[model samples]
Target: MGDHEVLASTGVSELSAPGRCSQGFGVPDLNAWFRVSVWSDQGGMEAIARIRESLTLSGEG
Candidate 1:
């Protein structure tokens, strides 16, 4: 969020489960906040998509 802008927001929520999480989201369970943003239409979404694709390739979401 340093140089980028918030193009969309879905707020935040809490998660509680009795088992391990594959996304590693449970490790930093304290930071329940979640967000994603664009970089002023300067290939922002593309960069994000690339990152998402990479994560997907590595078994992440």
Candidate 2:
């Protein structure tokens, strides 16, 4: 918990769906997280990787 952190989760379901979550943290509580959902037949790690990349690019790791 070095000032800021990123949390993410990915899963599959009956259907494929793209989802994203964003949150702005306050000074006192610098925390951020996102979740992704996709079709059960699809790969979940890709979605999770995307989220991680986004966070890294945004410098919110």
Candidate 3:
């Protein structure tokens, strides 16, 4: 929310097995949330972290 008004939003819940999580963000006049689920039978948490690092978000409004 840099340079923009901050709106209210709920926080992300705890992540369990199967590499899944819910992420949320809020900005002036808007709010959004998303769920990320990464599946891999190997590499464990490191794999999830690596995959997550590659995720990106882009928008214009």
lDDT of 1 by residue, 1-61 (tens): 1222222233222135222121211113233334344443344445544544443111122
- Stronger candidate by lDDT (1 vs 3): 3
Please give, for residues 1-61, the per-residue lDDT of candidate 3 as tens digits.
Answer: 1233433234233457534433333443445544443344454445545545565545554
Which one wins on lDDT? 3
Report clashes for each candidate as comma-separated counts.
Answer: 0, 0, 0
**Who is ahead in lDDT, 1 or 2?**
2
Quote each prediction's TM-score. 0.28, 0.31, 0.35
Cα error, residue 35 of model 1, in Å, equals 2.6
Error of 3 at 3 (Å): 13
Question: lDDT of candidate 3 vs native?
Answer: 0.43
The most accurate candidate by TM-score is 3
TM-score, predicted candidate 3 vs. hidden true structure: 0.35
